[model samples]
Target: MKNLVELDKNHFIHPTSSIQQQQEYGPKIIVEKGDGIFLTDKEGNVFIDAMSSLWNVNVGHGRKELAEVAKQQMEKLAFSSAFSTFSHEPAILLAEKIASIAPEGLNAIFFTSGGSESNDTAIKIARHYWRIQGDTQKKKIVALKRGYHGVAAASTSATGIPEFWSMAGRLMEHVVHAETHYMKGTQIAIQSLREIIEQEGPENIAAFIVEPVQGAGGVIVPSEDYLIEARKVCNEYDILMIVDEVITGFGRTGKMFGIEHFNLQPDMITFAKGITSGYIQLGGVIISDHIHEVLKEKSKGTLFHGYTYSGHPVATAVGLKNLEIIEREGLVENARVMGNRLLKGFQKLQEEIDIVGDVRGLGLLGAIEFVQDRSNHQRFAPELQVAVKVIEALHQRGIICRPVTYEGVDIICFAPPLIINQYQVDTILERLQDAILDVRKQLG
Candidate 1:
């Protein structure tokens, strides 16, 4: 274990991690195995995977069924490119299954390797769709503030978080962000979208991309009518709507897809993560029938955009088995039921703990924000590192979660595996309460 830690520190440059921290502390935890909702480290310490390991793993972990399917598919036909009319059965069947379950009129699928590539593909498709129709002016993409797409070049530019921009100097051009999270009582956010459209000259805008419920941006669930109004605005200006479901798709939010919560029919839906329960790498963009028709009718010789692993056979096979497990076990419904318990637990914590401020959740995705004064909702000083400290305490208490301190908000986020049971939910809440209390006492 020591040698493994030393090797990791010397050779591994982890994604989305601080290099300095890794050098100083090695790895946070050397996870050795996962089963159901629990992960065991090399040191034999057990932990509840509360964040689903980056908001994926909807079907939990250690599923031999997915492994068997991947093995069988690889042995038979490891890989075959989907480009140039060369196709395979796994890709075809997976695409068909996804289309059948997807919202109405979204029947076309374009496979990619993962979330970032999927989102980048969707953005390119939106631009290509407009270009094919001689709307060459429609090149700009508008995303919502606090919305997370991916880390690819185009996806990063479309992402609304500022910290992501600093990773690589000068993100892609022609992407802008508008206000978001305005509830039913306020139309400021929607109005902001309209204003951007008007200022940018709707003709210059290709698509308006957003997440149904912001995940990394603190699980911010917008008002019920927020997306409905945004959809109307997009329709009014002829701007295509793209929903980034990378984190919210495949039962993460209780529903099959997060857009289902708002009854939205977007022009494009980018998805990944839970499709295969993180058992294998797979993702794709689902396009509405209208957009498919446009592409079919207008696209000339080679589409000229695709990834080497666009339609991996083994990955798609694993995805099919993963989806089968989700349906057979009814994990979506389980997520809904457990989500209610989790939210209630959050409410209980908020009521009992003075530092616990706002609690918000949608399906299994939830967050608890910390405040210095509950009466005025004043935040603790940044130096206090309240969210980080609480998360560390939870880790010590055998729970895994995430901390969101972006834009002056101190929030602890949770998205446990959809297969989690009532007892597990209660356990998470109990430990979380203890962790928060521990942090409070330390602060005092």
Candidate 2:
């Protein structure tokens, strides 16, 4: 253990982590193995993976089928670039399968390595599509404040989280942010977007990107008509709508995609995370037939964008098998059932706990916002790091969750795997209750 800690401290670089803490303590837990919704660390202590390990891992872990498919694909033809007509069966079949399950009219798929790449690609393609249509000036992007896209350059620029932008440094200048759904309500959010569009002049805007449910920004589920109204506003301005479903795709939302819950058609959708259920890296952008047809007709030559691992054979194979497992096991329906149980549990906690201010969830994604005074919805002092403290308490009790601070409020999020069972749900609630109790005592 000491050797491994030394190795990690000396050589490894973690993402979105505290470097000072890592240098002082190495890792919080060195995960050795995972099965279903539980993870075992190197020290043999088991934990409930309540956050689904970054809100991916929809199928849980230790799935032999995904491993077998990956092995077979690797043995058959590990990798061959899909650049310029070169292709593989896994890539082609996976694309077809994704199209069949994706929202209607989003028939075209462009493979990417992961969510960040998918987001970056979506930004580029949106501008490229407008360029092809002879609107070269329509290159700006509009995103929602408190929405998280990815950590890549363009995507990071689109992120409404101020801290991410500060750390990323020198973000793209074309991106602008609008009010989030939590600003007032969906109606106010829609109006704010329209105001931003008017201020920026729609002629300069290429696309408006949003997460159907903002994941990292506190699992914020907006009003049902939020996206619908926003889509109408975009349509009114000729701005393409892009949905980032990296965390809400697959079965996390209990509907394969979060957008399906809204029943709105987006011009482009960026997906990852659950496509292969973390078995392998795979993500892509599904464009509507309109964008595809425009590109097909007007592109001069050479798209001038792609990744070495794009259309990777093993990754696509794993994705195909992962989708198969999700369907055959009825995991999506399970997510809906289990998610309701979790949401109800949070609501119950809110009723009992003084600090639990807001409990919001949909499908398997949920969050419990903590506050100083529930009556006035006063946030705890930031210096106290209340959410982080609660998360530490939860972690000590053999549960893993994430702390989300957005809009100057702290929240603890839950996004268990879609395969979670009733028993596990109950266990999660029991443990979480105890953890909150511990924090409350400390606070008092």
Q: After superposition, how far is residue 171 of candidate 2 from its true place, in Å?
A: 2.2
> Candidate 1 overall Cα lDDT vs. reference?
0.92
Tell me the deviation in Å of residue 387 in model 1: 0.5
Regions more than 4 Å wrong, model 2:
none
lDDT of each: 0.92, 0.92
Which residue pairs in model 1 clash with each other? none
Tens-place lDDT digits, model 2, residues 1-444: 889999999999999999999998899999999998999999999999998898999999899998888889889999998999799899999999999999999999999999999999999999999998889999999998888999989999999898897774737988999999884798788889999999999999999999989999998999999999999999999999999999999989889899999999999999999999988899999999999999999988899999999999999999999999999999899889999999999999999999999899989999999999998889998888889988998899899999987556889999998989999999989988898888888889
In Å, residue 81's CA in model 1 sits off its true spot by: 0.9
Query: In model 1, what is the error at residue 57, expressed in angstroms?
Result: 0.6
TM-score of 1: 0.98
Task: Enumerate residue pairs that collide in model 2.
Answer: none
